[model samples]
Target: MAEESGGHATTLGVRVEAARREAAGVTSYVLTAPDGAELPRWSPGAHVDVHLPSGTVRQYSLCGDPADRRSYRIAVLEQPAGRGGSVEVHRELRPGAAVQIGLPRSNFELVPARRYVFVAGGIGITPVLPMIRQVAASGIEWELVYGARTHGHFAFLGELAAHGDRVRTVPQDTAGVIDLDKLARGAAGAAVFCCGPAPLMDALVDAMAAAGHAGQVHLERFGPVATPVRDAAADDASGPEFVVELTRSGITVPVPRDVSVLDAVRGAGVDIPSSCEMGICGTCETTVLEGEVDHRDDLYTEAERATCGAMLVCVSRACGRKLVLDA
Candidate 1:
């Protein structure tokens, strides 16, 4: 979704200027500088890591205007059954509360495109909301296929309505699930950006791959995905070492069996920003120049992995002796 230099993720202290309810169980918090100053700049598909008062950290996509440096807005959905981070945010992060936040990191950053197709489900719309605005303002051809539990469950329907016929609202209560095959067929030659529940994201990725359009797809995984428990000892004992050539940094580093590419790259002084090193967060996604990968990340489908256009450097490794990376 983007091209930016990756480095250490920094932390900042900010105050919640306002908190407005966006939808049922959804709250949008506007965070601003504590001393009437401007916040860091961020592009579309960016998100910040919020350290809650209860010591739980959660990442939320920036849904506000990127031009507005005065404040940064993020929407959170109360996931009572899933995790405690959202619950804590909905309860404690009210207006006037001071909170610690991470600088915006965007694995889902929006790049220039020919045509754009955005498929968002439920709370997944947060990252796509700003993308739509940016694309629409650029006079680029784009459309959004948004689905929710019900019509009222939508957070920014009012804002979406301004775009007229380009938005397709599919409420699952009355209409069935979005037809993945149809959506993929219609998105030919268009760059597809999808962020949604696991099922929808998984199915659409398969559909896109089956249609031979995997190269133009981008994704943002909002929540955690199931991953096999990583046994570091087992990996250290059996993992194979490989050489990585960082084209951008004009350097090469040896990735030992015990260490990951993320650590190797960072150790070599080329810092690729990462979060949730388990490969579920998609933050360590790096462009692949050559060599097949033993893809260990949950972010890519089986067919998408075959493309090998990118890999999550945190947990994924090389399938050959030498690999070239665009990082």
Candidate 2:
């Protein structure tokens, strides 16, 4: 087994034990800690940061049973327009390849509720799948509404089908669009967990809200939306670089224009916990001890953004060229 790192450390070295093709363009990787040791135990909805070549690091959720401590399993869809991370993992990474992984983090966790409803679209099933499995294993009442562009694009159909009546697959080509109104009706006291394309999530949120089920909804975003061009006046070229003090480590890192505060801190080997690398997952959220953050993520609500004191590190720049983080 690989040497176990200290308790809940931010980063650890792991090795690829195996990789196999799962579908047309998806592959699953089995990662084991160094020396083939047991990996850190993680819960449902947890994800890890995968360091790919070209310095492109991406996050993928653990798709297998969290109780299985021997290794972690992650499935990757080779997006055509990807920044070469998934493709490189599929083509170049081989067994025994070493990679750095961040500790498991989760914002889309399952909360205790009377019942559960899971909605997944295409690759978004990566996180929702394990949650469904855990709910099923625990004998909790749950149902899955999975959608894909086509039947061929759907993963885990066999397992889902084996569940008989509990899971429903909606292929867009065959089933048209998912009827959120029907799905949300009579769903009171049931927590709804959804992960899918933004449009689908938006529809679900709107439909649930109209059906009076908004309070039971939870979502996770996988990427960032394109930001509009900032007004010229908002650009301050004369602003001086600010210092971000890490509260836990007592380290101060300079936030330069060329690099984000996240990059500066990570460059110093201080793991601030991030994923998506795109301001979406809210994984690298840290409290603001001082300074304003030009919040850039779409995940947090306006009120939550103001009250949480947390900021997404992927694309959010410091409002004053420097921001203090509770690292």
User: TM-scores, in order shown?
Assistant: 0.74, 0.81
Q: What is candidate 1's local distance difference test score?
A: 0.86
Please give the CA lDDT of all the candidate structures: 0.86, 0.80
Candidate closest to the true structure, highest TM-score: 2
Q: Point out the worst 10-residue segment of candidate 1 by lDDT.
A: 1-10
Model 1 TM-score (2 dp): 0.74
Per-residue lDDT of model 1, residues 77-177, tens digit only: 99899668889999999899999888887778787789999999999999999999999999999999999999888898889999999999999999989
Clashing pairs in 2: 1-35, 1-36, 1-37, 2-34, 2-35, 2-37
Model 1 regions more than 4 Å off: 1-9, 223-277, 282-295, 298-327
- In angstroms, give how far residue 325 of model 1 lies from its true place: 19
* Clashes found in each candidate (C-alpha, N, C closer than 3 A): 1, 6
Task: State the TM-score for model 2.
Answer: 0.81
Model 2: which ten-residue window has the lowest total lDDT? 1-10
Best by lDDT: 1
